[model samples]
Target: MQPDDIDWNIINILRESHQNNNSLARELGISEGTVRQRIKKLKEVGILKIRASINPDVLENQQLATIAINIGESSQLEAKAKEIAQLPGVLNVSITSGRYDLFVELLTFSNKGLVKFLTQELSTIQGITSTESFLMLKSYNRYV
Candidate 1:
């Protein structure tokens, strides 16, 4: 379903801060029921999700890293990305252009855990020709 102007406005407000139906309705000059229904429809259609995110840097013993991967077969990029997404500690996976076929973000308990993931878990996936990992040193205004 396509979102109308009202829906977009609702989304924009929600993006900045969590608002109840009454507040959204008052701000948008719409009825509370309309605001409620629109939010429901937006979520049902997978266009919107409401959840809290935390900065990984603030978490104790947690580390973040990104891996640039080159696979043997370009045709299998999507399949490989999906497979990698299911692995533990994997946060995000994407098929990309440039020197790599896939870019993956991972979250682990420590640097050692990251090594275990690279050596033990990721080693099981075939067709990955090579991977270069970068441990995140610092981030600003980043949340996961």
Candidate 2:
């Protein structure tokens, strides 16, 4: 989905206050009705999707990790990314440039559960040459 500048500006403001159309309108120097209309159009055109993001720290027995992976082959990148996307505990996967072929984000209930996902579920997929997992200790300025 492609979002224009105004849409992006609206998005930036909305990220701070998803529920306050009046505040968004004030920030954008537009009317609340216009802000509402733009948001509706954005959602209808599939340029935007609104969802709630739960902070893992608020809950007990929860953990978040990011895994950078290097693949064995270029041809298998898309399929490998898709396979890893379906693995348990995996929240999102992206094929990236530079140092890593794929970046996978995951959340698990416990450290042992994360280990099982890394060793068992991730091992099930081939052509993954290496993986480096980083556990999130804390986050500053996280955007929803």
Candidate 3:
């Protein structure tokens, strides 16, 4: 199925439950093959990903923190961000347009683990000038 042929009802159905392809197709009055084809095309074009994501809060030993890092050189932004993304606890990284050069979401099992990550790992990165961290105390809305 082509992008233009994709109905909003199909999108709604998919959003509601991507796993239930046959149910979605039946509700939208289309064949399951059509839904599968569209989903495949969407995945091919980098529009969709069906992957499981864990909630860190569910894991009692884990802690999540958002750390904003200021960089010394704009030229090293991409390379530095990529390096930070590879760090053990680093879950997500984004280069943003603000006072900080990059924002990183990290997860660690203990205070020592997080401190080791920030002081030993993150501090050694070439372009990083400063880091400000905010520990997530509580969450009102956890869904991504």
Show where candidate 2 strays beyond 4 Å.
Answer: 20-37
TM-score of 1: 0.88
lDDT of 1 at 137: 85
How do these models rank on lDDT, best leading? 1, 2, 3
**In candidate 3, which residue ranges exceed 4 Å CA deviation?**
1-18
What TM-score against the true fold does each predicted structure earn? 0.88, 0.76, 0.80
Per-residue lDDT for 1-144 in model 2, tens only?
687787899988767656678888887788999888988999999877788877787777888889999999999999999989998878899999999999999998778878989888999998999999898877665522
- Please give, for residues 1-144, the per-residue lDDT of candidate 1 as tens digits: 989999999999998888899999999999999998999999999999888877889889888899999999999999999999999989899999898999999989889998899999999999999999999988888777
- Local distance difference test values of all predictions, in order: 0.92, 0.86, 0.79
Candidate 3 residue lDDT tens string, 47-138: 66666566667777777889999889899999999999998888889999978989999888756778989888898788788899988876
**Clash pairs detected, candidate 3:** none
Span of 10 residues, lowest total lDDT, candidate 2: 135-144
TM-score of 2: 0.76
Give the CA lDDT, 0 to 100, for residue 102 in model 1.
94
Residues forming the 10-long window of minimal summed lDDT in candidate 1: 135-144
